[model samples]
Target: MGVLESILRKDGRKFMKRKDSDAGEPGRALEELRGSLYSDFHTSDGAKRQQQRLCGPFVAMTFNFIVAVGIIMANKVVMGMVGFNFPIALSLIHYLTSWFLMAIFKALSLLPASPPSKTTPFSSIFLLGAVMALATGLANVSLQHNSVGFYQMAKIAVTPTIVLAEFMLFSKKVSIQKVITLAVVSIGVAVATVTDLEFNVFGACVALAWIVPSAINKILWSNLQQTGNWTALALMWKTSPITIFFFMSLMPLLDPPGVLSFNWNSNNLFAIVISALFGFLLQWSGALALGATSATSHVVLGQFKTCVIMLGGYIFFNSDPGIVSLSGAVVALCGMSFYTYLNLLGSKESATTSNKLLSKQNSFSQKPKTAEDDVKVEVNTLSSV
Candidate 1:
């Protein structure tokens, strides 16, 4: 009887041990599965975030390009082809349309509002507004006087102008490579657009005059963005009203002959409305593009837009873009591409250096001095004394 009891006890123990092992196996397998899923989820999430970061700027740039092209084409049709012939009035219509759109956005709470700046004086805002008005007005006059291709070619100078303004106003230094790139772009533009047969001295003057204010306006916008933490819409809202006021004040001096004498028709009215809408879209998209990317990126995109406009002018306006002009445009675009590559390389190096410094700082901050280390330091100091 004792031997049988021993055998039963031994068998029961073995059975219980096997049951426990079986349960443990499933539990460990479940934990491993959960860990693998968690790791995969994190990996995919990080990849998605990276994609979104790249896609956002790309989308903004593309939108700005399309909108800019549409606006230029529309303006060329209205002011150049349709004989609206009212540059100031046309500019006024643009601002009014922009203001109306902004008002609508504000009412719907779709526009992001920025807090008012205590340090920024009203005069500064007025000055920015005046510059905006003058830049747009002069650009329109230039466009009216020049062929579309020549007008776009003239805009190639804007990049170098901005670079020059930065150097003069902010004491910023550009690299020799960048300077060479700028020279190449300028030379190419001169070759493409500046022909004695097609060039009007007045138009060239208008374009050159437009460059200074445009550069200053961009610098001011960038400054306001960094210092005031203002969004694109907020900046637009603040400046649009002042811009409208300035345009109205200047209308008397700048308006064309017999402002109210032209016969108004549905086709002309439709063209005016379309041009105004395109103008508003141009401003909004341009602001958003600048907000999404840097000024350099904006300028690079501008070069691309100029190329597109130049092509469009050939197709739509029947502008004679000679071999020299086409070659010049290609050269200017290549220089811009080179400049962009250098800028990107510099930015990457700067970011890497910054990251390394940040990591060193974090590591230094993490290591606190222990009591023993403090005692050793004090002892060393006393011994040295």
Candidate 2:
């Protein structure tokens, strides 16, 4: 509450009293005052649940874009001032160093939580982190073989993999609309890949690897989010150490062991900060959202990431968002929107049915949580090549 706004407690009820000033209309002023809380301050149950439903995947999709775009721009920025001489070594080093910083931040956040039980198994998180690292490495390798289309298709498949993984690992259900959204996004990705129709078998194989761990991580993280209650930073950091381990283990497996060199350049630091800033903001917004409700709903809703970037690239990068790409974005986004709407309806209906069940005094107590408990997991940085 600002000082100029009068505050009063009458009959033990608090009310805001705003004085007339240059504050424009009272409604606008009131909305401005409540700006920070607008997303979560809804008084209606329906609205609150709706946000809960859309929060997870939305954040996940947004995070994916931020990380990808940041890295692309950062690489371009570094090359303009520096050069590719540093790419082979510095890129890898920057990635490792950023992992260390992320881990430090995550550790700081977990300080107040009751110490992680010594017996709690972390093997799954470790293995999943390694999967992400390998998948990312494959993505890096694919960059050398094919055009941008290949990259988009390979990554877009992650959404469907997530849906399937959820069902296999946690018995999650998907509506027809979500299935449609998944297919549309897949088409966008595949069509994007067709930009390089001459992709070789090896390149295609490398590209396909991008989706495997991506989907796996999503499922693992969704489970973790539901049960872990850890901040995104902490979860990321906690799993991050495993990536280092994965890298170390890979050193000897190559023809000539690849070493992760130290590159403590200014550009490296800049990329790290940008990555962390985006990570902090995007994840925090998502956490607030998931606290309210379906991780799956959020993912399906977030495919618009490709659409926004496609438009921006067309405008600034001189590459046209071709009729095909634009149509793909539209089709994909529309399908995702329908998926989101139907999922919300299903959740609300399920909640209502459960409410009725409670009122009936049935033999069995009503089970809570209308939707599957979901976890959202992701790893992206702005420093990768």
Candidate 3:
């Protein structure tokens, strides 16, 4: 009986050890998996950052395209087809709505709160706001006076204007390839859109006048983003109030005399509200795109948006696109594609250079002690001892 009891106790101990080993096997496997995952994540950090950088421009471009198309369609329906014909008044409503929306976003803490700018004064912000208001208001006026095709042609000018302004004002250098791309895009837009070059002197003047301020506004927005560390929302919030004030002051002067006499209906009211909403979105998206990329890229995106809108017009409004238009669009697309490829190549090269630098830095920081270092350490230790 004593031998049997001892044997049972030994068996029990063996079973407990077996159970402990089983548990530890899973824990060791889990630890190995965790280590593998951590190593992968650490190694891919640079690639992840590159992907994020690429995604910024992509997201910004998409937002700009969608909001721009919506605004263009809404504006056409409201001002041209519906005969609301009050561009400045519409702009005023847009600014007001934008300010209200920005305020709501801030109140809800949906956007990060940016402290007031130390480098950029409030006066500079207000001036930028005024320029933006003027540029957009004049653009609307130009659209009212010009045909859709002509308006799009005028828009094509903006890219070159911005590029030229950057070169002249900031001494910024654009690659020859990019410059050629811009030229191709401009020519394509002109061929695709300009069917009948209807020259309204007033419209021409307004379009030309807006170009300078529009260019300046884009550059200023980019600068402010870098210098002020401002997000799209924060910049818009700061500028919206001044824009609203400017629009209010200009509306009375610039709106057509018949604006007050227009018949009020549910359709008009709905269109106005929708237009205002789209306008707000346009401003927000445009700011985001400009903040994410350069002014030149923003202008290129505008050209792309024009191409899409032209296609949309053909499909939805039965606006016949000629063979020339189709060919021009293809050319424009090719140019944009080539430009994108160049940008990607540039980005990859930059990332590779950065990685090389980082590796060198790490090697330098983690370098092993030399023989001289060891000798000095031994001498110091011996003296202390």
For each candidate, the alpha-carbon lDDT, in order, equals 0.76, 0.56, 0.80
The C-alpha TM-scores of every prediction are 0.75, 0.62, 0.78
- lDDT winner between 2 and 3, please give it: 3
Runs off by more than 4 Å, candidate 3: 1-55, 312-319, 367-385
Candidate rank order under lDDT: 3, 1, 2
Better of 1 and 2 by TM-score: 1
Best by lDDT: 3
Candidate 2, overall lDDT? 0.56
Which structure is stronger by lDDT: 1 or 3?
A: 3
Poorly placed runs, candidate 1 (over 4 Å): 1-57, 146-156, 196-205, 292-297, 311-320, 370-385
Query: At residue 61, what lDDT does model 2 achieve?
Result: 51
lDDT by residue for model 3 (1-385), tens: 9999999999989999999999999999999987765543333332233323554878978988888888877988887778888888889888888888878876775544454466568887888999998988888888888887778777887887888888887788888988888898888878877777686888888888878888888988876765455666677888888888888887877677877788778988898889999988888788877777788788878887777777777889898788899778778877888888887787799999999999999999996999999999999999999
CA-only RMSD, every prediction: 10.4, 17.0, 8.5
* TM-score: model 2 vs. ground truth: 0.62
